[model samples]
Target: MVTTAGSAPTPGTILHLREQGFRVVATDIDPAAPGLYLADRGHLVPRGDSEAFLPRMRALCESEGAVAIVPLVDEELLPVGELDGDGLSVMLPRPGFVASCLDKYVLMRELSAAGIGIPRTWSASDPPPADVVADDASGGFVVKPRSGRGSRGVQLVGALAEVPAAVAASGYRADELIVQERVTGPEFTVSVVVWRDGGVQAVVPKEVLLKRGVTKYAVTRHHAEVERTCRAVQSALRADGPFNVQLCLDAEGRPRVFEINPRFSSTAALTVAAGVDEVAGLLRQAVTDGPRLTDTWREGVTMVRRWTDEFISEEEFASHGLAPAPTVPLVARGDDPAPRPRSTDPASGVAVRAR
Candidate 1:
């Protein structure tokens, strides 16, 4: 089972899991999520933060006979992590680690204390002393929500003086945000898969070429420093599941970690494409003893985001109790616009035009 089917990267992840011969049960708050229709089955559930979300998810797993869960969104991680027990297997880092990762300030403090390379960070309310601010005028500071993922509420300012206005414009309380010296250089999103006994399974470092909230264009690359920094993070956090490290290299080629996403990022598919199927391997380990992973993975594999359309006939749409699309025929019933190959799934009676 995977939650947040509506996310951009989920449908491809679902298809990849299915290709691995797993019966995927996708769930989302919205019924129209494309992954829902592509999965073996799907269910609509309450929002991840709602009190009712866990109960519905528990019941849905039992009803669907799902043995494991992979939460794709941050909001659902804590609640879903609690579901890990003898009966159901949940893929998440330890509760403490997850908690720390969710709060940027706490995460940086802890990692910094552990001697990991971290940007100069402080709670928004406790602004850094004027002398401590980097003298490089071109190198700005970042003001972001203390407990959120991605660049949604992050703001960049040329100096500490602009932080006040940025926070005020962001509509977040001073204490609810964090200020950090912005690190610059080549950025990489590294995936570190750890085993139950804290063994580092595989570290795949991807050089990010483009990003919009999530990575849109990335290529698998081998950077010893980046991989070394990620392993150091695993050693510090001791996360027993998969987590992604977002970092940047300074002028000296040292990796400075900026954020840690406790769950698989949208780039999980890219990891799979590069050769290590982290999701499938983790699921195997969670259910039973799994194989050991090696450090060798093909590099230079790239992933580019593209738009894909999934078409559903009016009849199949109505079967799910949803409003049907316009009844007008795409072309006149007997008129053949062009020759196109068509396929049908007998079980669901959904026909598709393949191009």
Candidate 2:
């Protein structure tokens, strides 16, 4: 049995695991979590601060005869690592490795030292020596939080003078921030699933088509640079579990490491759609007792954001005495037919809008 904690298990992942013939138990601190509704057995626990939660989790695991614990959220990763599983395995990297990857600055430094190509970066707290900053900033620069995720505290600033405010808004002292010389290029994400026995199961590369406030909105598979970069970073990090590495292709099309996520990423859904079952890989690694590597690639897959409406119906609007759907006037008129009101009904279903 595999147990998941924190956020509810993603439906895609849960369904994939079930198809792979594994029983999964999912838990979250919020009982109303949508993911819980689809789980085999969904339960709630006290929020992150509660000490009693670990015992509850342990009891659940014991009762269910759980063979492994899999943490689905960032907050639960470390805590789950620290929990005594009574010899039951937990599907996660070592605690130290997880911690190192959580901090962007540390991960960058390690990757750079390990001979991985990375952009030149400086800590906001250290601010680089005046001479070093001057040398590296020959181009422009980006200021971001040292440990932030989702581009929450990332800013593209043209001059060093803009650094202080960006760092301040990042919720970190100057020393706890990282300022990197902006590497101009197209960005890509490589999602790979690795097993504990030093094997990479799948590599899916995505070209970032649209970024909405740092979150990827549109993406498609077309480039092999992501695979090369993934291989380099995976070797550099020496990570033994599922992880993602973000890279930027420089002017010459060379990939440079930007950051690393040491767990399943928000973009994992895209890879799954591209025919890489990461959850299945995790389950295989957990239940099997041998070294395994998957070198599969699914190219030419595309994913785009969709929008749709729900609740209000066209009939209901007509019944409410609203104007019928507008029609284009066929003959010349003093004024054009009033435009149809935009759909105000709340959207519920997925809408696959073109990028």
| Candidate achieving the largest lDDT | 1
lDDT for 183 in candidate 1 is 81
Worst 10 residues of 2 by lDDT: 346-355
lDDT of 2 by residue, 180-202 (tens): 87777888777777867666677
Query: What digit string (tens of lDDT, one per residue) describes model 1 on residues 171-210?
Result: 7898999988888888899989886689898999999999
Clashing pairs in 1: none
C-alpha RMSD between model 1 and the true structure? 8.8
How does model 1 fare in lDDT? 0.80
Candidate 1 colliding pairs, count: 0
Clashes of 2: 6
**TM-score quality measure for candidate 1:** 0.88
lDDT of each structure? 0.80, 0.62
